[model samples]
Target chain A: MKMIAAQALVKALEHEEVTTVFGYPGAANAPIYDALSKSTIKHILTRHEQGAAHAASGYARVTRKVGVCMATSGPGATNLITGIATAYMDSIPLIAITGQVSSEMIGRDVFQEVDITGATAPFCKHNYLIKSAKDIPKVIREAFHIASTGRPGPVLIDVPIDLQLEEIDFQYSKGPDIRGYKPTYKGHALQIKKIVEAIAESARPVICAGGGVITSNATAELTELVEGLGIPVATTLMGIGAIPVPHPLCLGMLGSHGVRAANLAVAKSDLLIVIGARAGDRATGQTDKFARQAKIVHIDIDPAEIGKNLGTNIPVVGDAKIILQQLLNYVDEHYKEKHYKTQWISTITQWKNAKPTNNIKEDGNNEQYVNPKYALSVLSEVTKGETIVVTEVGQNQIWAANYYQTVYPGGFLTSGGLGTMGYGLPAAIGAKVGSPEKTVIAIAGDGSFQMSMQELGTMKQWDIHIKIILFNNYRLGMVRELQKMKYQMNYFAVTLEGSPDFVKLASAYDIPGEKITNNSKVKEALDRALSYQGPYLLEFIVDPEESTL
Target chain B: MAKHTLSVLVENHAGVLSRVAGLFSRRGFNIDSLAVGVTEDPNVSRMTIVVDGDDYTVEQVTKQLNKLIDVIKIRQLNPSDSVARELALIKVTANSSTRPEIIQIVDIFRAKIVDVSKNTLTIEMTGVADKIAAFEEMLKQFGIKEMVRTGMIAIERGNQVIKIGSSEESE
Candidate 1:
């Protein structure tokens, strides 16, 4: 009838139906690890705490469950900060547990003691510092609840070792009675009716979807609403797979370097319906100029994001899935046979035909090296738009966003908000672990790949099937491109010199890899890597001067 | 930008104050004055916060605070429709010569001498910020020794009430 807090935490994790966890063990976390060793949960030991965090996020993004990660106190907890911020910015539901010093030594600055709760307060949706063993059950339950609910975000828990050592008469328990924390799910009926009426009345209407659509898993509802009204859909980077990429009415991504057609359609549309999007600077170039002709309707769960950057004619604060479902229902009941004009569709199609957005040609001395765009196109062709494509930030992410086709929601995972360079490699590992049947790939730049390449060891250890499509341009190409465009072609410190021999590095980890150059070699190398049974790497010799255009 | 007065109801729990303060400080929103005390329900506490910001900033602050689990409700108290007051204690340098003068001043201001010493007379008063400011301005001529003031606390003028309703379920 009685147990230690460490054992109780494991029980809580089991009760929540968590099958996998990513973490590292240390002195402060010895008790928890001891109990974890006896539990049935599969624990992934990552090389760095950051990898543990990103891997957890990747797993969460794919499974839509609260991904759990752990680390010891002080340095280990500090290392998880970037990963926590990345997940927070992306609205991923995660449970990050960190070991703490004994309660008596918390403020005394003893060995491995740090105020992790204070450090993570601003980013995490909620955090707790466990002072008593009896509070562990309720804390874990509330942690999971707060993590996966309305607008999902990361939550943190810091358990002092002394508390974990305390034995109490603990029984398996339910969650806390939190009366003040209620989230509005279903939107107002009047607002739904108004939105439906607006869609019905508009001639040139466009639907813009964001990461919130994927988080809410409302891709089906969004398709029904937009396609029913014959409205073309333009997505942000995070909303890449909100609907099938090849759908006829899709304008693809719209923003700073978006598809020309998507941007043009949004600029010309009369009514713009923004669903689960914050309209960031990258997504909305020149806020004053963005969708100037459109009367926008913004729907999101977070009230702060409603009018953050742009003004909205109608702001609906509720879950995207619930609101989209209501809108679809209203449309079915009131105007089931309603048809919108095809004039706007014809105009967008003309733009799409004038220049295929995915077309990338080998230009400027391309005989020896692969064009980055060409490599991505081969990736798109080989994967058939059906694989999980996790991309690191910079030119690589932009290229993948430009060319890759997504077949399903949550198909593309990228660090859009925080834009951490080391995100892709570890996240792909997590994604693969979360779904073993699916093919997972980390499309990364050379500079970004090395940032978290330690995860390559984790992959070897776990025997996961993840293909790494390394675009080795031998430099940080995105920053170089920015400098070329803005600073009179002056480049300094952005180039990657003294970098490790990547193929040799992978081989050392027993991960077989092939070095690729020339546009013709890309398809064959990717095919070979993708066909490999276990983890494999393909390093592409991309032209250093190639920009993302 | 203009000054705003908001009354926040929060669950009486540890870390609630730190969470609220952390949010405001992290976002660079300056708090002019803050006062907290338990409400009629021992389970909940009331906080009056004054900040200077524009409409958009206030909306952002309100939305962010609402995201916290411990926060129950937030209502901006309108000056014209609310009765607000603050309590302050002031100690003035006093002697036999100025003792009679200070007593006359306290009588006129409706203040009471809570403590008296050889070189000082400590007076306590409860009133709106403007009234307290006027009293201090006049008493400063006699050379004040020390002073402490509680931030503003408010209630609606009449039958209009702001209630913190606890929902029974989440989602």
Candidate 2:
């Protein structure tokens, strides 16, 4: 049976069980749109290609499925780069399909022609440029497999206009068997036993969980291991919500911006079992000083990451979920003798209790601006640590990460690696779409919120009921503080002086919004926004001189 | 710091070269020399990469190269157990007065004069990288006009081989 590549593409998506796609259309992908219209898949027309990409990322994170996004050639594909890079950095599984000019016109520099595959090669996990319609089904299958497996990241498929119009014999292929693309899922038994012995020998053992816990859905296994072993857990910025913050064993995030106690725990440990984290500079501070006293056991799916940043004494290269489960089993079976970490826990507890971690507390008497931390604490309190908090980078992100206190697995989403601004609003829309039962809130600083403010139209048009919490500091708060700390307070190009009244801007989209000026009204304002049935925006006036800590 | 040679087996495709080269440049790993050619298996390609790095850097380079989807396998070729060769073409400025001396030097190196004009002689030599460099250095006194080199290529001696599914011998 013969079918157009566009029709076969839609069929391929159906075979993969893709229920929704975030996209922006043009002449290049008009045939795909036409085919998509006849299928059961839901199409979300984002205001910009960037929004579509981010929204797909959000959807992927919440659904734990490969997010799909599409855009036309040139500028449309270029616009998806930041979001692609953002997904790549965080290891979100995504498939970005872009339309190119006709096959012959690709190299001729015709209208709307860009080498998107080459442009995204540095960032994307893999990419393909389709030359034949017959290869669509196999390529799509491979793209999905590659995007979702190993260290999940974005995969790009560039289809030319002529290929989409070409008729080919259609047959959906089986799962990919690329010889060179095998991902080791089962860990070595000897390495697992070694980790157990190291755990049993240490007086001060700490587990550093990274984004891999969430990516591999190993949160349950991790929580079990942490609880069973009575070992303290410190998470990277990307590792938030891997173990609930309320858990006594949880020491919160560990990094430059991480909690002081978590950092101390990692530094003082005799043995550190690092799972699924790269231990990047931000997380490790200075690599030599990071966990200097500890014998590190690094467990990760990617072999390259095991000893990339920090030296590893015992390296287990496999999926985190499997390895953690193996550790759990080994502990349950033969590890009868338990090492006491009472002094270690008490020491960490004392450090956590010490008030200097958050030295800049709300003075309570300030009437002009809201304490952003205090406001987020209220949001956490009112929501009962139940909301999916997607935060834009800057002061707002750090505040949310510290204060939100996510209780469930995968409850927090942010651009931890890339630290992309304007990520929250669109991501919140995607999360809400993916998980309709949960309340999703996008927390953004004033400067970051306006980066993708046009996404308000996407929410309004799709009726996505995501709450937007914009912290109005009237300046690029994070950069201003950076200048104050490092550049001798020479503030230039950091102020949002010409920014619009965000509340009024939301009103123009007919979304109800409120503006609060002080900490006293934070809970009431958040409660109001969360209680509203439709989309809502709540703006809080934060102090211009507010410190992140 | 130290020089190491890695023989990588990759799927034969247009993008595989870029993917391997891009990984090196992106990761800040410096490649001193690289040579790629089709293997006995038509679908497989072999790449010999000579890099300057310490043990840590070599480990990282091998691991990073293995990460690319096109790369099938990698083996760090030990100098004692492997045979390495490089081919270089030297275009030396040759006049009637200098021709005999250059030819004698070429004869000693067992190099062939592949192309010759009245003004220059292009000598093709196949040997170890150091030997080729030494030959080039000897000819530099004669005012060589131009040169090209196919970096380096190596294979295991004594029946040991580098091929797909032969990853146990890799670093």
Among these predictions, the greatest TM-score belongs to 2
Cα RMSD (Å) per model? Answer: 2.4, 1.8
lDDT of 2 by residue, A142-173 (tens): 99999999999999999999999999888987
- The stretch of ten residues in a row with the least summed lDDT in candidate 2 chain A is A355-364
TM, chain A, every candidate: 0.97, 0.98
- lDDT, candidate 2, residue B6? 94
lDDT for each residue of candidate 1 in A1-549, tens digit (9 for 90 to 100): 689989999888999999999999888888999999999999999999999999999999999999999999999999999999999998999999999998988799999888999899999989999978898888999999999988898999999999998897767666666766777788888888888888878888898999999999998988877777678999998889998887878888999978998999999988899998889999999999999999899999988788988899988989999999888787763374565647777888888777675545655656778887777776777788899999999989988888888889988999988999999999999999998999999999999998999988999899987888898888899998888889999997788888888889999989889888888777788888888888888888887788786
List interface RMSDs for the candidates, in order: 1.2, 1.0
True-structure Cα RMSD, model 2 = 1.8
In candidate 2 the C-alpha lDDT for residue A346 amounts to 84
DockQ of each: 0.69, 0.76
Model 2: fnat (fraction of native contacts): 0.69
